[model samples]
Target: MPSTPDTPSFHALIPCAGTGSRAGTAQAKQYQMLLGQAMVMHTLQALARVPQLSSGWVIVSPGDSFEWPTVNWPDHFRREACGGATRAASVFNGLGVMLQAGVPAHDWVLVHDAARCLITPEAVSQLIEACRDDAVGGLLAVPLPDTLKVQTSTTQSAPSPSGPRVDATVPREDKWLAQTPQMFRLGALHAALAHASATAFAGITDESSAIERLGQSPRLVPGSAHNLKVTYPADLAFAELVLKGRT
Candidate 1:
């Protein structure tokens, strides 16, 4: 793993280039308003509010605008345009930008989604501070409150009329749902992702998988349900309520 950069401060990498087809909106979901501003705007605000988060860089799509072009960014935030097909690809491109800008390897690189509008500065601070100990890196996660399920191998239990197992719910013993703003040392995370991409294992979903791929387990820092991503349109309403609480 690479060593941490001399710069101890955290920098945010918000990937706002997704089409958000699941959101069922004409405009990209990140460009849509949750309370009043664009979804990405809220996420950027939450990160920027963290005193330790010295700066922010948003990765936007090639043709698409970073946003409506009317609303201005926070004092120190900047924009970049290299977005990728997968979230990992987009992040890889942004990492390069940060490196070219001479960001340190030790600096905290937080990868947050644009749709998670309920995120708060407090949550961001928790994530940043947790990354301090080099032995452990952290990701915001919520313990499982709902029951989980593990169906049989086949969709149908009857296996073509032969005796078969039942569609049973799995025991929710210690499961946790992972959230974003996942922070890690620039060098460590970069090496992990690079190794994963080098092999045929490009299907990894989250940053945790990249760590696990390198034979290390990432620590989970508790996060609230309010940090849920805005996948469906209804999620915007939930995020609106979450935002109201923090305000």
Candidate 2:
């Protein structure tokens, strides 16, 4: 379907441009097998269950040669090769394409990570419901459940031989681990990220961070711990276990 304007719509913007060097995979981790399909396929399948989403766009880096799974793929969701060097850049560029394609500025965009294949439709729906009427959008997050730690400061000449011991225990109160499907207005998120583009998107780790720089606070809807991003090799095993359990 073609992009429509005026009426507010929910769109999923997934940035799938990163190299999975840390994952020890020969290809991008998103394309790596998970359960019976590609890692990102699981992510997209979950998004397809959300009835409120108008469309989903997967952003891949230019010249990405990975063959995407086409069988049973949602017609409303498609891939675009407008990815940038960093996650923030990919998101910003994706937003630009959406706007140019006639997506309304007031429309809601849920930015999710392709590696976070465990995200459920329920969690995404919760975020949409929580932020749909609010002035600023929100993201699904979980309160810090584990004790926080700060690494000991080390000098350039001398490093800790004990593999960087913890210097202090940080207060976990009021601290939350940010998670994906960060819902925000298209114009708001685009402008926030555009502000940081000059600095190569430095300090902009997530969509919420970019929005925070605009002096606006995003709401935090409680998220499930099961919604984890697959980064390391061990994480894939855990994700597969979880996916199998869900089945």
Candidate 3:
């Protein structure tokens, strides 16, 4: 279906406040160089291609000291320095800023990961096309292909280090590994995240989780495995290779 005049505008929100300790980088992972540019620059470049997006916002730490790139940014792109300590907090805070700026509650918001530098414009467009008119919104995800194992271990064994034993094998038939640009309505997401914060829900890993708390199941659009999140040092090289392949 085509978007009508009443259809809410789509906006992009990227949370980039984390330290990325596991990445083993001296600086924040988003600012780390990838393909001769800051990693987050690639993410923003992909977002800029989505003409349907009304605007793009990056949530950064209040005291962030990293220097922004000198390249010309998209005219619709903006940055907010009200990021919080946790990912959920950062997103929620950014949402507040959007509301203050008069962005309608019913407007669609695509929350993407800054570290997912391999995310392509095609993948982002796929997500928007699938969720633009969806009642509950959705996200980009890839199904797991590897055999799953459930480990059993207890922390009480202080005498010696013991290896975890596989307790069971989980069925991967209906399982999907979640990825981003998670799309949802601004009001609904804000309410969900607020509820999570009030209830002290520490497991609010992603925006979808907060939505799930409201009993809404978001659709999972198929995404490529190449859209991997750059979590570790080795993953940076893999992302670089993917970028090179595109050229």
Off by over 4 Å in 3: 1-5, 155-162
> Which portions of model 1 miss their true places by more than 4 Å?
1-7, 69-72, 152-166, 199-201, 245-247
The Cα local distance difference test for each model comes to 0.79, 0.91, 0.90
Model 3 lDDT on a 0 to 1 scale? 0.90
Candidate 2: residue pairs that collide: none
Please give the distance, in angstroms, between residue 56's alpha carbon in candidate 3 and its true position after superposition.
Answer: 0.4
Indicate the worst ten consecutive residues by lDDT in candidate 1.
Answer: 1-10
Task: Report the error of model 3 at residue 149, Å.
Answer: 0.9
Candidate 3: pairs in clash = none
Q: After superposition, how far is residue 27 of candidate 2 from its true place, in Å?
A: 1.2
Please write out the lDDT profile of model 1 over residues 1-247, one tens digit for every residue.
3334444767888887788989888888888876677878878877778887778888888777543544556777888888877788777778778888998876778888878877889988887777666564879999999987654676543464665555688787789999998887766777777787776337678777887877887888999887899999888777777777777
Q: Compared with the true structure, what per-residue lDDT tens digits does model 3 show for residues 58-104?
A: 99999999888657577899999999989999999999999999888
> Tens digits of per-residue lDDT for model 2 on 1-247?
4435445789999999999788889989999997779999999999999999989999999989988878958789988899999899999999999989888898999999999999999889988989888888999999999999988777633676768887789999999999999999999999999998988999999999998988999999999999988989999999999999999
Which residue pairs collide, candidate 1? 4-106, 5-105, 5-106
Judged by lDDT relative to the true structure, which candidate is superior, 2 or 3?
2
